[model samples]
Target chain A: MTTREIILARLRAALAPAPAPVEAPREYRRDAPVDLDRLVDRLTDYRAHVHRVAEPAVADTVAAILPAGATVVVPPALPPAWLPATVTARSDDDLDHTTIAAADGVITAAAVAIADTGTVILDGSPDQGRRVLSLLPDLHICVIRTAQVVANVPQALSRLTPHRPLTWISGPSATSDIELNRVEGVHGPRTLHLILLP
Target chain B: MSRTFLGMPTTAPKGVGHLRGAEPFPAAARRALSDAQLRRNLGHATATIRAKSGAVVAEVPDWEQLRAAGSAIKADAMARLPELLEQLEQRVTDAGGVVHWAADANEANAIVVDLVRATGSDRVIKVKSMVTQEIGLNEALEAAGIAPVETDLAELIVQLGEDRPSHILVPAIHRNRAEIREIFLRAMPGVDPGLTDEPAVLAAAARRFLRQTFLSTPVAVSGANFAVAETGTLAVVESEGNGRMCLTLPRTLITVMGVEKVVPTWRDLEVFLQLLPRASTGERMNPYTSMWTGVSPGDGPQEFHLVLLDNGRSAVLADEVGRQALHCIRCSACLNVCPVYERTGGHAYGSVYPGPIGAVLSPQLTGVADNASLPYASSLCGACYDACPVKINIPELLVHLRDQAPHPRGESAAMAAAAYAMDHPALYAAAQRATRLSRLTGRRGRGLPPPLSGWTADRDLPEPPAQTFRQWWASR
Candidate 1:
């Protein structure tokens, strides 16, 4: 018999008189109001710069966060208005790793945000292009709409489509390997700027 | 090798994986305990993580409820594992991914090596995965003339030092900053002439060294933290963006996952995603978590292969009471909280999996006879049970395995004798009275003679009082 058949048969035989099914108790909090302040607190705790701005000022905020004349990679569908003329913006149009790595930063809109854990979810949506676009760059400038914020993981997960590739970012890359001391900024983007729009 | 002509084997062959240590736990633990430096590193690391994990866990008022839910989901998944795995395979295939099954470590390793060869990549970057370590995949790749680059910082440290991983969350928890700096300076190519012991500086050195490889590596191998059966989605939770660099940059991504890692649905992630980060690295969420269902065109890796590795997981699942060991999320919370682990460190347990979880898990995977000493490695303090986010009752599993473990004839006889004496009040009192003879040796016996000495070698045998407690009570 094939290894697959052998393994499945072994499993079946082992579970002969299969145990009774158990219903998971999901009594944990869910579907609660998104607390923006809590989200800000968590992001700040992780050393990510957070800026609360009016929807109209998002363009100005993105511009101010980037160094003048810096090159930034943006998703193909990112709103043209969000990219100020001050920075040279390049769309991720079949960008290679080297090209993505060469960019000074990356800007993208998030799919959802979790307040309790201070994480931003990016599905490979039109605005959040490819996962590599955010990964290779040194700085990641993520724009989160207030409507996109959720209370916790379950709520944020409900909003995500599983088939789309997803990347959840809680903070800039970090490691606690050395003496268990948390040192932020490893292979991932070292600088994270979160622009919260209402 | 003898040509065996015998009756059919009564049981399946025991695991030939990295489940057994070179020596028994007591001997290995003796060597580790003598390393004062290792003890200090373990003590400091465990204390720091315990504080951090406690603080974050306390933040959530519903942590207990979450733990309950996490435990139940895993139990439910195990009860219907065959169905979930089949579902996972079907979904992954439907999503344009290939799925392979391996019944043992050798099969799994051969499959991965061939897959890498098929891609014609002599070198493959890797994410830190316990299953790969358990299977010794790196060695297998090297034997096939392939070099596997470890991207995770701790794993890199362990690799460069030619060291075994001593902890789960931070594999190099035994390494302090100065030691890491020394390793980097000695082993890493193009390392700065003057490297500081600062954690950030060391991390930067790694980033600089690996950035080129991450950009160029054509193939990557990873282990899934969770694989959703319903959607065929695989999630890898990591701190550094190295996981993204691997899962995204590589053209052909191969993920080796134990069959037990499969969850019933995508939504089940909510429970684990919450429980894992707090229990591991004491974070609200790891910096990056990448979830991909098979392959996403024009996005991450276009070709994905999920290797479902049984490698004794089915054997572990076979035992009714012992099956709960499969529920572990590899958070290493139990390791951090275990007093015995804090003292002797991971090396003592002698398995890639070390600490309270490993004590029970290793024995069952390799069978009780092979890893007999590990079941007794714990103090049965119940700390691991309390710390487990999935609520694995490790202390209970330890006792259960101990029952199955082979005991020396002398030890068994001693226990049986003690049990018989306790059954008879007169004999018990006489036995207690006879213990007074031990006082003649000294304030303490120091060490027992012959067969009994093994038990007292690592532990202290308190001196018998001048009078028995029962005698004193009767006099009063």
Candidate 2:
């Protein structure tokens, strides 16, 4: 028999007297009323800058965080209205590593925003671009609609697609590797800016 | 060098799947305790992690429910492990990923070495994985002339310093800033001589050194935090971007996973994802959690292979009461909160897994007799039980494992004699009278010589009292 068959045989023998699998008792909180205020507070606690802006003023929030003439990379599906006209914008569809690394920051939309943990889930959807676009650059400016915010983890998981590559970002790239002391800004974006639109 | 089909040793004559350690727990712990610097380093590190986990765990009001869900989910997975694995293999194969099964570490390492060799690359980038460490994959690769570069910051510290991991989460928890700086200067080529002990400086130096390797390395090896049997999705949860880089940039990816890591569904991840980050690194969510299902056309690692390793998990699962140890998520929460672990650190455990979980796990994964001293390592204060995220009854399991360990013939004989004496009331009273006679020889509640002195080495024995309680009651 192949090693796989042997292992399966062993497992079957071991599990003979064990009970069958049952539904997990998920009596924990599954949903919350999408609270943008709580989301902003939690995001802020993770050291990500929380910018609450009117839908029309989205470009201004992006402009405020970046220097003049700053080169920004945006996912191909990113709404053009979100990027300020003053800065040079490059679409991330056909960008190379060195080119993306050279950009000042990345701007994209999140598939869902988890309010409880202050996490933003990106599913490589059209607007979110590929995982590399958000990862290689030094700064990330993520936009989440108020409607995308979910109260808790189970609620957030229900909305996400399992097959798509997922990057769940809570804060800027951080590390507690040094004596377990948390210091932000390691490899991903050093600065994470979350814009919540009502 | 390997185990037979029956899980007996092929190279080593006696113990199979046992870690190579000469000193027992007490001997190693004594040495670890005397090292003042190591003690301070471990003390500060565990204390900080403990406080952070406590704060985050308290925030979730339904944390207890979440723990129960996590436990039940794992129990269900173990119950249906065979079917789940078959489903996993089929799903991964359908998703364009290959799955290989290895009965022990030797087979797993050989498979990984051959995979890297097939890539025509002698070097591979590694993400921090306990299973790979458990199997001694690095040593196997090195023997095959393949160089594996560790990318996680703590792992980099351990690798550069030519050291073994002392803590599960923070492998270099025994080393502080000054020591890390020294290791970097001595080992890291072309590093700045003027580098300071500041964490940011050290971290940046590591980033600069590893970035070139991440970009250049064609093949990467990782351990999966969770592999969903239903969808064949694999998750790698990490604090640093090193994991992300390895998962994405590499052309070929090989993931070594213990069979017990399988979750029945992707949604089962919600409980663990919440429990893990909070329990480890005390974060509401870690900086990055990367999940992928097999191979994607243009995204991350064109070639994917999952090596399902069952080095000794089958043995662990065979024991009815002891199987609960498989529920460990490798969050290191129990390690951080364990009072014994805080003082002794990971090195004393003499296994890749250390702390309260390791003490219970290592002995069972190997034969209990091979790691006989481990069950006695704990004070049984039940601190590990309270801190465990999955609510593994670690204390009860420790006692169960102790029963499996081979006791000294003399000790068993003494125990039998004591039991016999206690069963007879007249003899029990006579034995009490005999114990009271020690008061005459053992002056000042101490100084009982020879066999009795072992008990009073660090503590004074309570005076037996001149009269037995029964005699005093009779007089009253």
Candidate 3:
């Protein structure tokens, strides 16, 4: 028999005497009230820059996070109204390593945001682009609407589709692997700027 | 040597590094205990991690509920492992990814080596994976003349220092910053001579050294944190972005995951995502979590391979009482909180796994007789059970494994004789009076004689009462 057959057969025999599968009790606190202030607090606690802005000031907030003449990569479906005129914004339609890496930062809208953990989930939606567009850049400027913010992980997960690629960004890249001491910024975007649209 | 993969009597795998070691845990732990440097490093690192884990875990009011959910989800998945794996394989295959199965380490290594060879890349970048360590993948790749570059900072430190990973999450926890600086200067080609002992500086040095490799390496090998059977997505949760780089940049991605890592659905991640970060790194969320459902048209790896490794997982699954060891999420929470692990460190455990989880898991995977000493490595303090994210009752499992382990003939005979004597009143009284005779040999504050001296080396045995408890009861 093939190794696959052997392994499957082995699993069958092993699980024969095993007890029937039981649905895990979901008694855990699945619902928590979402608060924009709490989200900002959590994000800032992880050293991520959180910018609270009005709908009209979203572009200005993005501009404020970047320097003049900086090249920003945006998803093809990003709203043109959210782009500041002063900075250079390019659509990541034909993303190559050079273009994505050369861009100063990526501006993408989040599919869902977990307020408790300060995490923004991007599911490669039209506006979110591919996972690479946001990962290769040195800075990731994630825009999340207040309405999209959920209180906890379960709430955020409930809102996401599993088939699409997802990237969950809590803060800027950090590592505690060195002597178990946390040092922020390793391989992914060194800087994470969250623009909260309230 | 040929052994059965349950029924198939295939050739024995060449490098199944996860098996039990030749050296016993006591002797190895004795060597580990005498190393002052290892003791200090482990002592400080575990203490820091333990405190941080406690603080973050406390922030979530329903942490226990989350742990229960995690455990139940794993149990459910394990109960229907074969069906979940079949579903996972089909989903992955439908999503334009290839799936392979390996009976043991040799077959897994051969598949991976062949994959890398087919890519025609002499070098491959690696994300930190415990499965790869367990399979001795790097050594296998090196033997095949392929250079595997470890991209994770701690892994890089270990690789450059020519040392094995002591800790699971933080592979280089045993190394101090100064030692790391010296290693980087000596081993990392073109590293700045002016590098300081600051963690930031060392991390930056690793980034500089590995950036080109990440960008250039065509093939990447990784271990999955979880594989969802529902949608066939694989998740890699990590603090540093090295995992992201390896998961994203490489053209060909091969994930070698144990069969037990399969979860029923992506929804189950809500429990694990919360449980793992708080337990492993004390973070509300790890900095980067990448999830992919096979190959995306324009994103991530264009070619993907998922190798399901059985090495010893099926053997472990066969035992009804022992199968819960598969519920481990590799969080290292138990290791940090374990009193025994804190003093002896990870090296003494011998296997790729160590500490409380290792005590139960190693024996189960390799058979209790092969790793007999591991089950006795614990002091049964039960700290590991409290700290375990999945609520694995490690102390109970340790005792269970100890029962399965082979005892020395003399020890077994002594236990049997005692059991026999205790069953009979006359024999019990005679045995008790025989033990009291030894008390007359030494006066108060004197050392014990030959065979009993080994016991007194650590603590003095209390003097026996003049009359046996049964005799005193009878007289009263």
Maximum-lDDT candidate: 1
lDDT of 2 by residue, A52-171 (tens): 888899999898999989998888899999989778999976687778778999999999988888899999887988788888778899998988999888998889888888999988
Global Cα RMSD, each model: 2.6, 2.6, 2.4
Cα lDDT of model 1 by residue, B79-137, tens digit: 99999999999999999999999887888899999999999999999999999999989
- lDDT, residue B218, model 1: 93
TM-score of chain A of each: 0.97, 0.95, 0.96
TM-score of 1: 0.96
Query: After TM-score superposition, what is the CA distance of residue B339 in candidate 3 from its true location, in Å?
Result: 0.7
> Comparing candidate 2 with candidate 3, which one achieves the higher DockQ?
3
DockQ winner: 3
Chain B TM for prediction 1: 0.94
Off by over 4 Å in 1: B1-17, B440-448, B468-476
Model 3 residue B218 CA deviation (Å) reads 1.1
**Which residues of candidate 2, in runs, are more than 4 Å off?**
B1-18, B440-462
- Each candidate's fnat: 0.84, 0.62, 0.73
Q: How accurate locally is residue B28 in candidate 1, as Cα lDDT from 0 to 100?
A: 90
Error of 3 at B246 (Å): 0.9
Candidates' DockQ values? 0.67, 0.60, 0.67
> Over the stretch B59-140, how does candidate 2's per-residue lDDT look in tens digits?
9999999999999999989888989999999999999999999988889889999999999999999999999988888988
**Each model's C-alpha lDDT?**
0.90, 0.87, 0.87
